[model samples]
Target: MRERVNQDVILGALALLFGCFIALYWAPIDSDTGIAEKVRSRWSIGDALAPTVAGVVIATSGFFIALGGILRGTKSTLSAKNLTYLIFFLVIVFSGFLTMRYAGPIIAGALGEEYRVLRDERPWKYIGFILGGGGMIFGLMSLAEGRISLRRLILALLIAAALALIYDLPFEDLLLPPNGDV
Candidate 1:
């Protein structure tokens, strides 16, 4: 009997190596600023912060995935079903993003207001983020559970609201997606 390489192990190893390379070398060399810095007595994120955090997260996820594969002792292969799920997931995510980007502008336009001008204001700013983000949560949950429920919709909206608050309240300078673009 021949031993087959576990897909998780191979994928995880590649991710781990890629993440390490990014975090250790690419970010430091490419970025002009450090991950964080104090500017005029205010702490702020620098150019490298996003890439560094992403790398760390990828490495951590890879470590756990590899460990799980090792412990499970099962060979898993990517199949057509997995590809179908991936496509579905991508579609859902892109749809959600499109909603997030356009919902505010469309609603504002319908209400005879300009999104770019009113983006910083209350209600307007939260509209797209909450609706689109909630929709995303609802979609993903429905996809996973193979059913859509009112309860899930409510929960997803609440979670999205909380996330909007979390992002909005802390960073005064930060602009939500599409807001920056608009």
Candidate 2:
């Protein structure tokens, strides 16, 4: 009975994985930023960019693939050494999440000043700013954990600092529409 259940689970996992791959290949492109914007890259990580929004959506479904790969690669050893790996993974996850949440708003606000949109004008916009900021904080924590290379960590830190500084200057009026939409 146990063997049968395990077989079922394995089959289900495989089915899900295949489904995700299909979706990623077939999903429609985004209207606003286009497909490329969805997968924009950060300089800190060399040239590696984010996945297309469709890619993110599909790749996220492959969590099981990642889990299986990690499990298979580690040789099933229970040791104190494993704690370091666990912590490092957690830091990366946290950092990525926070950065994703805030990066959008921060960039928007920076652009808005040229377009005359106030950074603080809308409540939801503020939320994006917070998320992006949180992501940067997480990236910093990840660096502290030594998961990212020194160069990458420094780059991430610099980008975050620059972004924070950009947020301080008055940008709303500069970005305002000629008709004065604000």
Candidate 3:
């Protein structure tokens, strides 16, 4: 059997690297307008933290993934199972985001109350944080041509919980999101 090159890996790695560059250097340091504009005139340390970390992680992972693809070459097929898994993963992501963005407002309205702002972003943020981290873990571990295992699920949960805690607990009062008013 002949080994086939995975163009997706190479292209994806390159794209990730480019994204890292943009996020770390070129992306605007502050929000374009509104209260956020008054809060952070430039990328405060807190504002830059998430993107910088994410970009580095993605770029590093992309490099290893492309390398692995080159080394362990195999015939790639668009399998129905993989497609279904991908669709499920995407749905989970989009739903998490929608819930985060809408749930607060909906709940407030149902209670016949209005939030000081349009919505409270924290609860939804917590949900999204956990789900996002877990989705990533699951996608990389099980969806990527790997056999599912209980160990993986446990590890993913642990990792996701740790990440949420790291983002939400220690920095709760000290840091703010990019759009947050200081």
Q: Rank order by TM-score, top first?
A: 1, 3, 2
lDDT of 2 by residue, 92-120 (tens): 66666555554544566666642134334
Best by TM-score: 1
Each candidate's root-mean-square deviation in Å? 9.2, 15.6, 12.8
What TM-score does candidate 3 reach?
0.34
lDDT at position 88, candidate 3: 74
Which residue pairs come into collision in candidate 1?
Answer: none
TM-score of every candidate = 0.59, 0.24, 0.34
Q: What TM-score does model 1 achieve against the real structure? A: 0.59
Candidate 3 minimal-lDDT segment of 10 residues: 173-182
Scored by lDDT, model 2 comes in at: 0.47
Tell me which residue pairs clash in candidate 3. Answer: none
Query: Model 3: per-residue lDDT, tens digit, 9-93?
Result: 7655886787678566644454232222333466334455556666677777777777776776546665667889889778756
Compare candidates 1 and 3 on TM-score and give the better one.
1
